[model samples]
Target: MPDALADALYELIVATRILANEKVLDAFGHVSVRHPLDPQRYFIPRHRAPELAEISDLVELTLDSEPVRPTDFRLYSEKVIHGEIYKARPDVHAVCHHHAHAVLPYAISGQEIVPVFHLGAVMGKVQFWDQRDEFGDTNMLVVKPEEGASLARALGPHWTVLMRRHGATVAGTSLRELTFRTVFTCDNARLQSQAMAHGRVDALSPGEVKLTAAHQLRPPSTNRAWDYWVRQVEKAGLMPARAAAKGASTTAARAKKADAKRAPTKSARKNSVKSKRRR
Candidate 1:
């Protein structure tokens, strides 16, 4: 595959595994990446355990959430969540939806999920969407275009939105950014819940959030988190065999290079002898 296509697929796969590894996704949540070759299409796996997703399971769908090609695999019922968000937000290149337990309390109560730390500062001011308010409450699933569009309107320019009695949706300019935001949002929710017990929590001010979020979006910051999470998933044997084997080889190569640098060579020993004599 071409580099661009390969990178997109790799990021999609890694993002799924990373979210599952971080506990933001289990068997329920889904992640999607806009097609690299065609903006009108996106790629997401057919319904399956996220941690076990392989490249073959990925299905390409139109912006309306219709599969580009017919397949026997069952598509996710709430895929409209990804479709309508992409339709509404052209700047968004990746989307993730998770039924994380940490954010459930705030989602159910219509409480704002604010950034409690610099990492989660992408969630500067999260908006909440209530299915009951718009659709009179059926199953609370975003299965229709109208329902998804309503949720996207609530999201506005924010990176995340809480879905009442359901879960949360996060979008990003890239898969790495989306992965980082999703994981940290869940972590922030956990922290916020714990701190709220002491009466009040000092969430980051909008100005502070803006500053910290700018720093976190830098390539170095995102790559650091991605590397860490990917390693954790690979080491735990949760990733596919090809990815795990590649990770193992990459790790071994790095270790070998480090050992070679640390061990003194004949030239280095000669230089050390001279230095010792001078001492």
Candidate 2:
């Protein structure tokens, strides 16, 4: 593979694992990057868990979500989510779709996920799109081009859009930026929920959102966070092979593994006993 494509794939894999490690994506979500040399095509993983994604699992697809070449690999049913957004927004170089638990409450409750902190200001304006609005509710998947296009319209000129009762899709100018926005946006949602429990949410003002996002979303900040997340994935033993060899420590990975095997917490033990008693 060419250097550019290889690098893109490597970073894409890292972004996938980082999102999974951060709990922004579980088994169902996906992330994609536009082809480095081709505006007409983009790349996403074959149908599989996001955390398990590797370079070899990537498939190149057109803006219409068709495979560039015939393959037996199963594609994501919602691949059109990336393609249609790419087609609609030339400025968006990366796209991520996730149903993170933190964001789901807002998505299902029809509440807007506004910026509650400086980092979340990166989510400029969030839009909402209900599947029932146009498609009248089928299987709730954006499998069809028309449905994807409708979603693209709803996401018009925005950084993120929530799918009613589904998930949220985030667009960014680059892969790092997309990862940053997606992860922090979910964090913002969680913080918003906590604040709401206390009575009211003091969201950032428009001027504050604009100024802080401009300052915080720059390359230096994004790269700093990206480096930290890459190390985190490395520690979790999920970094891509090429990048993994340089910085990953077998000792640290083993230590983390050992921690996972430690006995359950007191709260967990209490919950288990309570469940048994009820049974």
The candidate maximizing TM-score is 2
- Overall local distance difference test of candidate 2: 0.83
**CA lDDT of every candidate:** 0.80, 0.83
TM-score against truth, every candidate:
0.85, 0.86
Off by over 4 Å in 2: 243-279
Give per-residue CA lDDT, model 2, range 54-115, as digits (tens): 77777767787776555577788888889999999999999999999999998899998889
Write down the TM-score for model 2.
0.86
Candidate 1: tens digits of C-alpha lDDT, residues 9-94: 76788899899989999778899999775687788887888877777677766777776554567778788889899999999999
